[model samples]
Target: MTDFTHMELELEAILHASNDNIIVTDDKGIVLRAIKNSEEFYGEPSEKMIGKSVYELEKMNVFSPSVTRKVLEEKGEVRLLQKTASGKTVMAKGIPVFNSDQQIVRVISLSHDLTEIQQLKEEYEKLQSKVERYESEIEKLKKRETPLDELKTKSPIMRKAQETLKRVANSEATVILFGESGVGKTLFARAIHRESDRHLQPFIDVNCGAIPASLAESELFGYEAGSFTGASQKGRMGLIESADGGTLFLDEIGELSLDIQVKLLKVLQEKEITKIGAVSSRKVNFRLIAATNQDLKKKVQEGTFREDLYYRLHVIPVEIPPLRERKEDLPMLSERFLHQFNSKYGKQTTLHPETLAKCLAYSWPGNVRELENVMERLVIMSDQPVISPQLLLLDSSQTDEPQPWMGIESFDHQGKTLKEVVLEIEQNWLLRAVKEGRSTYEMAKKLGTSQPTVVRRLKQLQSDSK
Candidate 1:
């Protein structure tokens, strides 16, 4: 053979040996050539495909949306996904050949099967979804475990409280947390919610006293669009409705008005709420955790709080002892706060012995929150690594004095009888003891009396004042 014939035979051999399916068509969309692999990918022999019109093959279901036809119509290169009669998916690209006048002369089509790659991509997506689901479940488990872990305490009373909380954590019973202001009632409420089965849901907290009386009803029960003057055009969902399938925490619940109390009672009883200016009531499902520093029983007797509502909320009551009652936990609580603030402010500071002594001695009327704030202030403002007692902003004159008659001396008792004078003195002493101490036990210790004596005297004092 001649050199030109040898080169043509070599080129044909290379084209036929290619793994990719190759097809060549004339400008009129008739197949001029096809590779041997066409039989494998298109379920047709190369000799049969040759000399056939692409439109006829497409009509015969050999392959879909002929790539040669696309290149001919667009007069340019085209790329697309194609499915063959053999059910093989492919990535097909069509290239157009132009003559000297820039007119279409021939079309070359190349295709790569993507069936295996597509299957792998689908498998990867499924694995990714499973991993995401596992991560979400792990996060929920951590949340459920951390609430009780976060309650760091060494006091017997606090340990008992935690045990009680653990016992009722899984129950759907309404919880009432009673304590002095700043005694971590809100924290305990949140802990109870987190440890419950509803931890994955939202935790909605509303300070009943913080909301205005004018807006309390609408804020708790929601309102329809244009229900009242200045109402939002889109309407608003109430705090109770928004907490559905979650925990609704009402802090300072005693501050709600009597009218709102009645409505809240209905929600607790019926598990439903009605929006303002709406005819229908929507059912709501949620765990209720209410907190208050005031005496709800006293409020009930005085007609300020509803009696039936108080009982409903008083289910599984959790009384958080004040800081003074649990003074043994001070060191641990203080150290925890110090570590927290150190990490926050990037400081390595230690409290002085005298500082801790002063902290333990002073009556923390504001409870744990007060100590936390003081520690944060010391961490931020102190110039040295060792915090001293002087760094604590507690007033010595207010806390160090032992006289119960400090403020009483300023009152006018000159014209009072001796009997009245002695009665005033007794009342002043009782009040001072109660104010300085945490509970009746602590008050009795300070007054050199029994806990029952302190309780009885305080009860009498409360009655006399009323």
Candidate 2:
């Protein structure tokens, strides 16, 4: 075969082997040859396009705004996004064949379907949107989650109170904490302030009961220079002014006199406060969190506490349950306090089960404060590594009388002999040992007997009981 014939055959073979649609057209855009891939790509047969001009094919909508037309007009390589009536898309690149005279002779157009690339791009966008949505949800959940790392609460009631505290933390609403004395109401108020938008600002804590009634007004609302005989010449900013843009935790609110209550109600209503001798009132913006152990409702009926002030401060009421009702949290609480006091006092003291049992059995009238104080005392005074029941020192009355919880169950003889009664007592003590996982030496120490004797009696008792 001649060189020209061989080249023509090689061109035909390459066009057939190509996966893309290839078309060779003259300078006027008359189709000379085309690979027959139109049926799959654009729902048109390439055989029907071989003899037609690209201008006629463009009118037939074979490929709108043809790449061949662009190459012919521009006289250079060009690319176009070619689409058909069947919604098929392809990226077509058109290159003009240059003659020896630097003139365009032919236009070679190659196109590949863009369906896969389009689908991949759409999938990437969808995945990115989902990732952003999930991140936003995770951040919201983190904000809602309890700060259990510092303040542990196992009771549902206490946890619900914490949830309420989180919900109203950012708003400028007044929160009133109702609970018995030593129920950690002050701590919850601090938590509310810590989680609020004004966390970086000051948290002014005031115990209304601790302050003397004579100076309560001047202490809360500040005083001007020479406002009183003993007042400083430079004047003073009280707790209310000092807590601007932050939180003012009024602890023991029930202790405030009726006169101070009226002034506080006016402050809550107007959002401003006046000094003792200042003519103009200064605007104050503070989040109020009041705590009281006294029954304010009864106080109001008795004409001691102001009813209007009660309603203002009672916007969000969160009651903290006393420790007695939440004894299930005792183990965690005691362990935490034990660990804390041990670290503080440079001691490695551990709480024994029997010692904890004494704590659990006692009615903690003073609540968590009492429990905390007891633990602190144990850590400081107890010399041994393990704290025993004798070292509990719970109450003076407890020392005087026998606690029923600490003693064994009382059983009737039921006409049985003394020997059977003594055997039953032994069984009760052994049962306690089993539950406690006590070693023979430990049992002997408790029983004031030898280890071998205790071991022999344990085996004999097990056989007799069976």
Candidate 3:
């Protein structure tokens, strides 16, 4: 074969091998050739498409607003979206080929089916809308007049705690909040920080129990670069250092090891922090707000916690009473949570009189956090505008009795195995526990298993449900 003919054949092979649908047209927008993929995208065979004018094709609606015509009009590269005769969407890019004279000779059109991309784009838009709505709600929540503005109460005990919080908010004295888990200790800490002079500064929270014992020190007191194996190339700033010129609220402070307790005491006393693997200490001016559900005095007596640290943190002690102790606040707290969740889920739901009565009567072991969770669940799960008392998932204020079965009943097993049935029951149990404000550690303790196992099971249950 002639060399020019061989080169032409090679070009044809290259065009055919390309994944993109390719069409080449003369400067006048008349198709000269089209690849096999053109039929898949444009619903027209290559042979039939050749020698056809793109303008004519446009008139026939073979492809709307032809990319070839666009490139010809612009005398340059053009990219556009087009709908094929079969109604499939495609993204097309047309590039003009120029000869030595700098005049347009041919136009090469490359297109890819946009059906999947369009679907993905639509899905992304929906997800983005949801994220934006959630963020807007979060911003509204943050801009509230006061963090404790939502802590509506009539109880003297809660009022006393609030009084103490307000009295010491501006003071630099270390404050310790002693309460049961879910009693809104963190909320009180945030309220204090917001009311303090450092309200404009950051409020850094560190969960001592959440971090592993091995990495607790490094996480609290950041290390320098190459301080240990697997350290970040840039030196890390510890949580304490990050809270400089702000307030550092350490939740579950009793979980800290004795060694960490000693270093923390130094920080409280000296108003400075020494990072791990560093010689010199850096001065950090931050107010400390430590909280714990455990009795630090008992922990110190048991030698699990240091006496000096206890004394240092116990300067302005605030005890937040649990929900069961202050049942008068239940109605207000429940109403607030209901409104919040209703706004979140785009629902207008209300508690039935009986449902409200049931909620008031229950001895909530999980406190305010649990009540919030229960309200959210009711908002999401209830079909009626007025939620009923029958919808209450928790047992009747009796902790000794087994939890009532709330799942769908399968009488004949429906051809399911025992394992599947057992798994469904277990998953339901775990979900209810989580909705009751039970953390992984709390769930593990109740289940007599490890925290990691509870987490894994919960994750598996979530995945299966999804």
The candidate maximizing lDDT is 1
Q: Give one digit per residue, the lDDT tens place, for model 1 in 1-466.
A: 9999999888678778887789999999999888887988898899999999999999988889789989999999999988899888888999999999999999999988987897798789867865675466456546433486578775668988999998998899988889999999877877887789998776778999999999999999999999999999868789898788888999999999999999999998899999999899989999999999999999999999999999999899888999877665676778878988999999998776446656755768899899999999999988999887688879655353344444447555667797876766676676566556645677788779988887676545433432
Candidate order (TM-score): 1, 3, 2
The lDDT for every candidate, in the order shown, is 0.83, 0.78, 0.81
- Please give the lDDT score at residue 314 for candidate 1: 87
The TM-scores of all predictions, comma-separated, are 0.56, 0.55, 0.56
Better of 1 and 2 by lDDT: 1
- lDDT tens digits by residue: candidate 2, 1-466: 9999999999999998998989999999999989867668656787888889999888988888799999988888998898875577789999999999999999999988897897787789867855664465345434533342357665556767778888998788889999999988877777777778876566778999999999999999999999889999968778898778778889999999999999999998899999999999989999999999999999999999998898998899888888866654666778767887999999998766556545655667888888889999999989999887688766634321222223324755567688877776665564344333335666567667777776676545433422
lDDT per residue, candidate 3, 1-466, as tens digits? Answer: 8999999999999999998889999989899989976777777888988999999988988899899999989989999999998778899999999999989999999988898889899789867965664465346438643555545575668988998888888999899999999998888888888888887666778999999999998999999988999998767879898788888999999999998999888888898888877999989999999999998889988999999889998899989999877655666777788888999999998776446545655778898889999999999999999897778888654332234545557323467698866775665565445434334666676667877886677445323422
Off by over 4 Å in 1: 1-146, 397-466
Q: How close is candidate 1 to the true structure, as a TM-score?
A: 0.56
How far out, in Å, is residue 84 in model 2? 94
Pairs of residues clashing in candidate 2: none
In model 2, state the lDDT of residue 370.
86
